[model samples]
Target chain A: MNPLLRVEKLEVVYGRAITSIQGISLEAHKGEIVALLGTNGAGKSTTLRAISGFLGLDDARVTEGAIHFKDNSLANRPPYLITKLGIVLVPERDKVFPNLSVVENLSAPVATAGANRKRLEEMAFTFFPKLAELRGRTAGLLSGGERQMLALASALVCGPELLLVDELSLGLAPVVVEDLAQRLVEIRDKLGITILLVEQNATVALSIADRGYVLENGRVVLDGDAARLKSHGDIQEFYLGGAGERRSYRDVKQYRRSRRWYG
Target chain B: MQLAINIAVLTAIYALIACGYVLIYRVSRVLNLAHGELMMLSAYLLITTASLFSKTPFIALGAAIFLSLCVGVLVYLFLMRRMTGEMVLAAVLTTVALGVLLRGLVVLIWSAQQQNPAQALGWVNHSLPVFGGRISAAGAALIATTALVYVGLFLFLRFSRYGIRMRAAGQNPLLAAQRGISLHVIYALAWGLSTLTGALAGILISLDSGLDSTMVLIGLKAFPAALVGGLDSLVGALLGSLIIAAAEVLMIYYVDALLSDVVPFLVLILMLVFRPWGLFGTREELDRV
Candidate 1:
């Protein structure tokens, strides 16, 4: 089957001296979740922003690249046009209109997208029942988890075919992260929509992703099945802690000692 | 009793002009400082059109409104569209330039003379009894016009889909675009409505007094109306105008005549000191970068 989305040699240069991402290529198939795992300062979010057309063309220029969304070229299109073409990006920083209520936030995409306003709203509410209960509450009053849920609901309200979720688990509690991850899996399973999740949380991303790519210093260092990558020696040593040996209560103390020595 | 009627008439006129200023400012977030100039120009246009046509008063009024809408749209497309971003100061200054240009253009066309169109429009008549004293026909017409404009604005904003979209665009342009509402179309509509309001206010003012270049200064009165009402609130504009007008009238009668001019400035200063967001504006709007 043809890939739902394709990025060919995507190079994003921040300035004259700083190259954020260099020669990165990836493909995401329909009805699958592809996680882009990376450390801090990795080009994961940069790649996502470039695809969504949020970053400035002149400053953080896409020096050499082409992005294909369902066979349509999206390299030079404006952000709104890209959204119209059925690709929605839930930005990293949860850019919700602070003063507007939850209902207004959900209704905003309807006003802009102009299709499936009713059905998509119902679908969003189903995925996030908490949102349905607090539809009248202003977005400013929502907690961190609720805000993330609202952001996700707002993006889904647009009824995007391909959802590019950036930093879904960022700055949330562990329990909240797990809940979000479960919801993402349930969404993919039930809705048959494609997802490209860019995240810094290696474990949580790999836990839900069908396939994962490890980005280091703006280049893809590893790409394989999620299950295999989870068990990979280097991944276990650095990211997952160890294979078949979870960090126990006593092991946590020893790990802290090693971490301090390494530091 | 005569003083009371005079104060009521003045309050109604001030409220009408304030409403128009607030409407345009709410949607576009740009202070059309030339708004007063637009009012003056439309009044002049109405006078010229009435003299040239010698037609029915209703037809002449229709022609004036049509002309003002056209001028408003032209201003948006030619001037306002070119001014964007943090250069709101530049945008305001450009409007000031437009005001000067408008005043100069009117002077050249009409020879800088004050002309009365109320006689031609058949508004000149004997005074009608109000509480215990009498009010002139023109003063009554101004109040009637204000009521008509208010009801029209209320229905347009509350029921019309485009009107709702315009309000949405004003509140958040990016979000509005996400739902396929073009900011340009909304801006044009806002300009059209704003011009319509200004023209109507100008006609009403001309009926009360004669039309002159100094009529443009009436727009300045709207600045205080906007400030007192809260720049973003239509209701605020109406209330603010009433307060300012009543205060001005009362000050002229009871305090000092000069206080009528100074009152709006005093209200503005007080608002700036305590509630810089005006009466209805949010903190976010005031802190917008």
Candidate 2:
């Protein structure tokens, strides 16, 4: 069977000069959580933005390659069309409408075709009951953790087949991030929704993602099963921060020179 | 008593027209400088339709109002739609140019003559007594229409799904679009509603007094009320109209008759200096523009 989303050799350019991302490839099958882990400016967000059709606002475009969702090419499509086609994005920032009340924010997104809006809303509330309590509160007044929950819940309200979440644990407490990560797993298991999670928190992402890809400077350097990645030597030294021995700066430079020779 | 009545009548005029500016500005952040010309055009539409359906005055009014709604939508779809993704100042200047073009067209088509639709429709502007002050029939209608329009708008925006979507679009267009709301449709609807309200104000005013180029000045004066109230807040528009109307009426009575035309703007400048966002407007709104 084909995967739900297939992105092959995707290249994105900003303002015709700067190439934000190039030749990045990934795929997500139905009912799986795939994590794209990277630090700032690693092009994780750009990949997600390309998939979700949000690059237009910044005058960026998917200049090369293709994003195929359920065998349909999604190139140069508007954000609303991309959303309506069942790929919903929970953006990195400004995820919820600040001025609107929680209920209004949830009500604002158009549900997927043939999906029951009220049922989806109820499903969202079921996943995060805290949102039910803060139904009347303005979204701007919510704390960082609560806002993240609201953002996740509102994304669910769109009834998407593929959910693209950018920076799920950003500006969030560790405990809150852990809980949200767990809830995300629960949501995928219960709703059978495919998820592409972009995150700087590699540990949290790997904990929930079935598969993982590590990005650096817009290129995918390594990818493998989550458990294998967790135990890998490079991941241990860099992402997991479990580098056992303290090496000198000269030793690090020597290691980098050897890495380029083989990498 | 007379002073109070004058204030009420002037308040009705300003509030009625001011909501038009608020409606368009709030949704799209484009100030329709041609609103005065558009308002005048609607009155002229009323004249043509009234003559066509002279026996059925209500039908003529309805047809004219409906045509004005179409005009507003077409204006956005054909002209202002091109201005989307451009700078805010450019869009505003386009409206100014549209107003100029429309003014020349109105004179060319309708011939700059002072005419009364009520006379053609065979209706008298009867003076009626209310609370010890006399009110003309059209003046009373203007007050009632303004009150009804405000209440209807308040209810529509607060409770309706489309209204919530409109507010959503106004706050964040990118987010709104991502959520599956069409920005073009929302913007077009705003333009239609704004022109519809302005048309109503124009139609009623022309029926009260004779229609001429001077009607454009009344439309222009009402803009300060919208600004004073906060360009985005409907409730602010209402309150701002009352404040400016009171100032203008009082100034004309005691200070100078010529002061009436300038008082609303003087109040607008004061509001700008003290509270650029207006009374009920969000402070962050000042930076968005």
Candidate 3:
């Protein structure tokens, strides 16, 4: 089966000077949950932005390589057109229209051309029932977890074939992150939609993701089954807090340095 | 009694024009300082159209309004479109320049003399008595048009799909685009609507008092009303217009006749000093402006 999204040697540059995403390649097959793991400025979000439409940085652009969604090339396309092509993004921040009511937020997205907006909105409410109850409440007044749920639901309301979530676990409790991660799995399984999740937390990401890629300094250094990545020494040491703390700082630094050298 | 009628008519005029300011600002966060000039231009269009459709006055009026809408869209496509990704200050200054250019263009095209659409259309600005006060037919129409426009806008922004999308675009444009809402279309729609309403104000005011370059001053005066109400809030604009209109008219009655032109700005200064966001506007919106 063909992958729903394919990024080949993608490179993003910011302000025409800084290279945010050096050559990077990744893919997400239909109905699979893929996690993009990285530290701050690892180009995880930049890669996601390139795939969805364009970088947030005003002068930033996909300077090299291409992104293919189905048969369509997503380069330089407007965000709304990208969305109409069925790739919806849940941005890292400012995801929901703060002043809008929960219902207004749900109803506002421009779903795929042929998709039934009513059904999508209902689907959103079903996935996040808490949103249905808070239909009249302002989005800004919602708690962080609630806001994340609304953000996801609204993205779903767009009837996306591929959902790109940036920093799904950012500023949220571990329990909440885990719960949302499970929801991501259910959404994929039930809707048969592909999900490319960009996250800093590897544990929650790997817990539900079918496959994962580790990006550092704009390069994809590791791509494998989620379980395999969980056991990888570098991932375990830097991402999962390591097996035991007694091992020490000198060895960990050497391990990181060696990993960077190989990368 | 005449004082109340005068205040109501002035409030309606200011309210109608103020929404034009609010509509454009709420969507793009750019103040179209050229709004007054655009309004005056629309009234002038009525003069040309009146002659074009000499036998049918209503057709001339309709054609003029339609032309105003097109001019608005054309302005966005040709001028404001370039400034979309640029700084807000740049866009505003461009509007300032556009205003000056348009003022010159209006004078060159329509000339600086007082032109009468009412006479051109073979119509009369009849003064009718109401509540023991008399109001010109055009004044009554202004109030009615203002009411209709606000109600239409309120309904459009609340429940309609495009309206919701427009609101979504206004609150967070990036998120709106991510949600598949086109910011360009929304911004263009705003400019079109803003100018449409401005046209109504200009056309009606010209019909009431005849038209000339001085109509721009009415457009400028309405700015304080929009500022006082809150630039982004329709409700704010409505209340703000009432406040500014009341102060301007009452000052003319109780204070000095010379204060009519200065009262709106005087009230504006106080509102700015006390509540910069206006009565109904969002506080953070001021920072963006």
By DockQ, the best candidate is: 3
Local accuracy of candidate 2 as per-residue lDDT tens digits, A1-263: 89899888898999889999878888899999999987799899999989888523468889998999996899778788888899988888888889889998888888888999999999999999999999999999999999999888888888899999999989888999999999999999999999999988889999999998888788788888999989988888888889888988777765531121101
Q: Chain A of candidate 2 scores what in TM-score? A: 0.96
* Candidate RMSDs in order: 5.5, 2.2, 1.7
**Which is better, 1 or 3, measured by DockQ?**
3
lDDT by residue for model 1 over B50-119, one digit each (tens)? Answer: 8766658878888988999999989988988765323456777788899889989999998787788877
Clashing pairs in 3: none
Best by lDDT: 3
Kindly list the per-residue Cα lDDT of model 3 for residues B75-125, writing each as its tens digit.
998998877655778889989999999999999998999899999999999
Highest-scoring model, TM-score: 3
Full-model lDDT, candidate 1: 0.78
Write candidate 1's Cα lDDT for A143-181 as tens digits: 989999988888887778888898998899999999999
Candidate 2's displacement at residue A25, Å, is 1.9
Between prediction 1 and prediction 2, which has the larger TM-score?
2
Candidate 3: tens digits of C-alpha lDDT, residues A94-161: 99999899999988999999999888988998999988889999999999999999999999999999
Q: What is the DockQ of candidate 3?
A: 0.68
* Best-to-worst ranking by lDDT: 3, 2, 1
